[model samples]
Target: MPKSVAGGTKWTYFASSNAQNSRSPEVLFDLLVSCSSEQGFSQVAYGALTDAEPTRRPEYLPAAVTVNFPSAWRERYAERRYNAIDPVVRRTTMQSAPFLWDQLAHKYQLQPGEMRVLNEAKEAGLKHGVTVPLFGPFGQLSVVSFASSFDDVDPEYRLSRLNALAWQSHHTFAEIAPSSEGKCHMKVALSEREKDCLRWVEEGKSSCEIGVILRVSENTVNFHLKNAMRKLETNSRTHCLAKAIRPGLI
Candidate 1:
């Protein structure tokens, strides 16, 4: 049984054990519902993107999606193809930070269609929410949104707790519903030097130290690491190592 905190926040630790042990989608959905409800959100949605060009536009529909919103609202959203104009989907592609729904207007100049989507969402009972964006080992993007009926939600306090639950939900879903596009199993080829650099990186080595150990210049070590990152389709050193290690590329 999962234990609840005093104020109904921070349930990730309690749910994590079950999340890791279970491979059922129903179990994952139930966990999401329970955790979101505890935190005051009445609706929750999870969407994953795969096999699409890594663009910052909301042109592609999520390859996989699950939501607990009203059926009427869901039907309307799909019928109108609102994903193409959804500001939240667009923002998820551009960054990995968690954001409040109300903050979108302040961050970007909302287009007419995007503004309409937000406005219609409010009328559908999704007045306030926070969306947490998760990036996979591949360039895949997953977003989890927890929406509330009221406008007085405290985003700062809820974002961190909800973010943890979102990640656990993502991992559980990924295990049960592996990507059909085969991206997760695709093999990335790295040169001998690149693999060597990444192996050193896995050992907690700095670029300068790795250069000394490999008898190469610091710039040369960085060059190899950057190449490894490109081959793995990742942006940062940490992401590079993680992706490389996942497929045993290193």
Candidate 2:
């Protein structure tokens, strides 16, 4: 049964049974649509970015995308290459957090161009929205957005429920999505030195401190950490530590 949040919005938490049914992209998208509708959102979109470089322009037509937005709006967004300027997309690369569109102006100093994108979206009937950003193991990024035409929705409750749904959608899609050239199954074997550096990093040690403990130069410690990141296909030290710890590699 769906639970009702404040202001009578029905929030559907995806149960394990529901997850089992969402094995295909079509089923996953349908689940998003149904959940969005139940929560008073008029549209839902899911996009995956193989390259999440904030400075680079994303492909106008993303390779992995599904949406229930209007065709005309979609055309406009693509034609204008709005993804490159969209504050939401930029924010996704900077953090792994779910946020409401209405909060963007408060959290970020919106440039004129970014503000224009938001205005155009509202003109196209996407007045309010929540977005969930998911980071992948190999520097990929996936985002799910639920948008509404009205402004009266409860932000806190809806964001919490939709955040759960977005994560479930990401995991289910990852399981069924095609892997390219064994990328998904590749083993990440860290060298002993790399493991040692990552273990020290996990304990909140600085590169200089790790160098002293390992009896190596700070630059050498950094080199091993970078090698570990390359093997793990992560971009940052924090992400590398998380990837290493998750599989008990360190």
Candidate 3:
């Protein structure tokens, strides 16, 4: 089914998944880049949040898989461990919506540290862009971001289109990339709120009902469920219930 998204964007659920199943992520990523080329995005980067290595570093920071971003920025980001302050990277695990870089910067009121990171990024020609975060079923997190030199970009229309395309690329990547152990080598830890949501889910409560019980927005309930799924490392709700039960979580 082709569903409507923000700004009248159309998403064909099966189309994105089926088209790139036969190919490699590298190939599929390049294919998406080619499509976005028409809109003047010269660079793209897809990062797997599962790459974080908090153990060996002086400060804990998640590593990433980046492509097409500027080499200078990449080096500096690592050297300074900027992941601690980069708003976009921090939000992907918590937020379901796609975010424009500047929007987040303002929302959090970019402190001096955050602003320095953004300033460096801007100097590297990554001044404007949108990041789409994807939470995979098996407790994995990834993000796809498109960057361009143009500052006068239209976020509403552009982000709506790019957000869908980013998911398409992500679904393609999941098909190709095998799960690997991280430095943590531990399962994702669910928050107390997520546990509450799962417990109600086990009791057959709908998301809306769960929201009412929890006194949060319906969307917040979905967010908690998605995060719980990522932590539980299961695609099916039934399987998640079983896994959580076996572990005595729910």
List candidate 2 segments past 4 Å from native: 1-23, 52-60, 180-250
Model 2: per-residue lDDT, tens digit, 10-54? 212332345545555666567667766777785888777656322
User: Model 3 compared with the native: what TM-score?
Assistant: 0.58
Give all candidates' CA lDDT scores. 0.68, 0.68, 0.61
Each prediction's TM-score versus the true structure: 0.62, 0.60, 0.58
- Report the C-alpha displacement of residue 53, candidate 1, in angstroms: 13
lDDT by residue for model 3 over 104-185, one digit each (tens)?
7667766788788877788899868788876654566677788877777665567655665665445444444553221123
Which pairs of residues collide in model 2?
none
Candidate maximizing lDDT: 1
Q: Top TM-score: which candidate number?
A: 1
lDDT of 1 by residue, 1-250 (tens): 1222211223234334555366556566766778787778868887765564122224323454567877778779989999899898888777667788889999899999999999999999998888987777557677788898877777667765566566545544654554432134556788989988866665556899999998999999999998887776766665565455434465
Backbone clash total, candidate 1: 0
Which lDDT value does model 3 have at 230? 74
Residue-pair clashes per candidate: 0, 0, 2
